[model samples]
Target chain A: MRNRFNEQLEQLNVELIKMGALCEEAISAATKAYVEGDRELGERARSLEQDIDHKERDIESQCMKLLLRQQPVAKDLRAVSAALRMISDMERIGDQAADIAEIARYMEKSAILRQVPMEEMALAAIKMVTDSVDSFVRGDLALAHSVIAQDDQVDSLFLSVREKLTALIAGGENGGLCLDLLMIAKYFERIGDHACNIAQWVEYAITGDYEDD
Target chain B: MRNRFNEQLEQLNVELIKMGALCEEAISAATKAYVEGDRELGERARSLEQDIDHKERDIESQCMKLLLRQQPVAKDLRAVSAALRMISDMERIGDQAADIAEIARYMEKSAILRQVPMEEMALAAIKMVTDSVDSFVRGDLALAHSVIAQDDQVDSLFLSVREKLTALIAGGENGGLCLDLLMIAKYFERIGDHACNIAQWVEYAITGDYEDD
Candidate 1:
């Protein structure tokens, strides 16, 4: 029974990594799509989001089955419950990625986006998502802590993006387009937040300390 | 054992309702503070958010204890898990309220906020929070569905707020203040999303269906 539980735990880890990879792919696709004004990529990102949703449900049932069958206690219970919490964050990351893609569909200001340079912001947010999941998979407490601290970087990037957009307006760029870019930047910041949340859960799962800021 | 579990579940309900009330109060206080430029109310809102955070931690451990002790399966398990999920959303609602308060602290434009009429948006989001919690308490599927649908109203209100802010900028209001107001509107929209999430968890608890949009 212990062997079987361990095997299932291993399976959960694999599934989580797959979900994380999908999230990374989704946001990357959406960001690239928006930056290049590629409608096909936007469409693909939305489909990736649906896959992420299905994975959330799939991983959720897996966790439930682990709980019911193993009746895990103590640290094992925390590990499984943390998986449950982590997936919720992953699901939201997917949603934010798709939301960015949705804006991309309507936004043809690839030049304006390049001018304000949200791609950097998107990359930073995506790195957080990737590192957070990596922290969970490797059980690296230091990585998790760094991921949490990285939120400041993403936030500062967002502020700079806003400043650039505002500067673009002062330079006679369209205010309307700046608003859309601002929304997109906000979505990326939210994705970073979700990543930070995943890292926090990873910390709780490992150290039994949950801190919210 | 079953009776004790039932009592604990009832206790959870009471705690959840209290947390919900705190969320409502926090948002209401923040909105009033922003609209009236009342620093005292903003301070009270921030304090209430701290209370909401404590309530979240308290309820989380309560759910963990119930799960660890009772080893509840099937519907009872679902109920406990759903409460766990619901508190996360409530915590986020508290955060959004405090974020609004933070914005309010720097904003002395009571007249401007009134001109944009975000009071209506705040009230709408607050109602969603109240009804979502009520649905959880009553297990009212219809009410949960209504709360989910009410997101559209909050969203349309956000669009109108955006439109008005744009017009205000066109009319020579500080573009910077409009941007801040826009952020405040987005935060309210996020509060609605969190409320929608809570209602969805309420629905899942009752119907075992989890839908994400």
Candidate 2:
């Protein structure tokens, strides 16, 4: 029974990594869609969200079954609880990706967004999301802490983008398009926050410390 | 040993509720300071935040001790985990209240604002938070769900406040004051989100569903 449980646990971790990869891809695609105004990419992300949701549920149910059947103690108990917390963060990340895609779709026809730094902020956030998940998979606590440290960069970039958008709006250019772009920038900033949230959870899982990053 | 553990669990719950009440009061005072341009109230809210932070750390340590001692299972496990999660939400709520107080301090001595509805929205949020903590204490899942449901009202009120502020800015009026007000409204909305988070945890502890609010 213990052997079978170990096998199941390994499989679940593998599935979680797969889910994390999909989440990264979704965030990447959504950011690229925002920059290139790619409607199809946004559509792809929306459709892929259902897969992410399904995977979240699958991992959760597996964790629940493992907890009930194995009644894991000590480290095993920590792993299962970590998985549970991580899934919640991952699912929220998926939702933020969909929100980004929706904003991309809204901006598909907007011509007033040229020269804005919103796209740059989105790319930075996507990179953070990818790095955070990679750190989790590698169980690299230092890397996770580094990702958490970069949250301030994303926040500053967001403020810069918002200021730029506000200036454009105030200057009587790109009136309607500025709002959509602003919302997209906000979504990217929020995605970065969620990424930081996941990195914090990863740190907690590994070190049993919930200290604020 | 089991009886001792249960007693500790009860004490933790009581302290968590006490901390929640402090946060609720801070949010309310901060909002009122914004509406009334009362720096005194803002200072009071800011002063109370440190106590909330101290309470949060205390409860976290207590819960850690309980987990180490009891290695609780099933419903007891859920209760302890719920306490941990609740403190996290409560801490964030404390931060949100502080955010509001900061904004209020920034707006102190400014001209009287025309948007009175912000006060109403903040009041509604405070009520939701109070009821959310009450529901947790009483184990009233329905009441918690209702608090979650009221989140939409807070959100809508936030949007309306934003629209009004934007209109004021677009009309070439003094935007500094309006923007500060908007930030206060945003803080209240976030406090509402934290309240919803707490309610979700309450529901999860009861049902283990972990469904979105």
Candidate 3:
């Protein structure tokens, strides 16, 4: 019975890794879609979001079953519960990626990417999401803390993007386009925040406490 | 033992209600600060967010204890887990309200409220938050659905606010102020989304399945 429970926990971890990879793929495709003005890539990201959503539900049920059947305690219980919280953040990252894709699909023009630091910011956010999940998978405390620290970089990028867009608007650029760019930047910032949340949960699972606590 | 578990569950419910009430107060105070240019009210909202955060930690531990100690099955498990999810959304509502208040504090001039549908939108969001939590406490599916439907109203109000703000900016109004107002509108829209999330969880707890599932 103990061996079976261990196997199931391992399976849960595999499922979480898969979900995290899906989120990474979704965000990467969405960012590529925005950069290349490709609606097909955006559509691909949306499809990935559906898959991610299914994975979330599947993994959530697995966690619930582990808790109910195995009645995991101490560190094992923390790991399972933390997985539950981490997946929600992962699912939100997928949703935000889809949101970014949706915005990309609606962009009548795509020059905003060239005019702002959005590409770099998106990449930073993507790295944060990927590394945070990786840290969770490996229980790497240092990597998790690094992911948390990278959030400031993403935030600074957002502010810079905002400043650039504001300057464009002040210079009589199309306000609608600038607003769209700002929204995209904001979405990337939010993705960073969600990634930070995942890292904090990772910390909790491994160390039995969050950074703030 | 069963009666003791029920008592603890009731205490969890009461704590959730208190947290929901804090969310309502935070949003209300923030909106009032925006409307009246009252920095003190904004400060009050910010302070309330700290209380809301503390309540979230308290309620979260309670749910965790109930799950671990009682090992509740079926509906009882659902109720405890649902409370876990609901508190996260409620905490987000508080954060968004604090975000709005932060923007309000920076608004040196507050005539923007008179220029847009922000007041109505803020009020609508507050109603959704209150109704969603009430639905959760009472296990009212119909009320949950009602709260979900009201999200469209808040969304539409957001579009209207954007249009009005865009018109003002196009008419050579202060771009910075218009942008700040737009940010405030977006925060309210997010509050509505969080409320919708809470309502969905409420539905899940009561029906054993989410609406989409």
Ranking according to TM-score, highest score first:
3, 1, 2
Write model 1 residue lDDT over B9-96, tens digit each, in one string.
9999999999999999999999988888889999999999999999998998898778777878878888998998899889888888
Q: What is the TM-score of candidate 3?
A: 0.96
Q: Cα deviation of A139 in candidate 3 (Å)?
A: 1.0
TM-score of the A chain in model 1: 0.96
RMSD of each: 1.8, 4.0, 1.7
lDDT of 1 by residue, A1-213 (tens): 989999999999999999999999999999988888889999989999999999988998898778777878777888998999899889888888888899889865547766765878888899999999999999999999998999999899888887887676666565566677888899999999999999999999898888987
**Chain B TM, every candidate:** 0.97, 0.94, 0.97
Candidate order (lDDT): 1, 3, 2
Query: How big is the positional error of residue A211 in model 3, measured in Å on the Cα after superposition?
Result: 2.5
lDDT of 3 by residue, B52-129 (tens): 989988998888788878889889998988898888888888888998999888876856569798999999999999
User: Best by TM-score, which number?
Assistant: 3
Stretches of candidate 3 off by over 4 Å are none
How would you encode candidate 2's per-residue C-alpha lDDT over A1-213 as one tens digit per residue? 889888988888898888888888888878777778798998878777877888987896687667666767666666677776677667767877887888678654655666677767877887778877888778898888888888889889877866776666566544335555655676677678777877887787787777653
Clashing pairs in 3: none
Q: Rate the local accuracy (lDDT) of all candidates.
A: 0.88, 0.76, 0.88
Task: Tell the DockQ for candidate 2.
Answer: 0.17
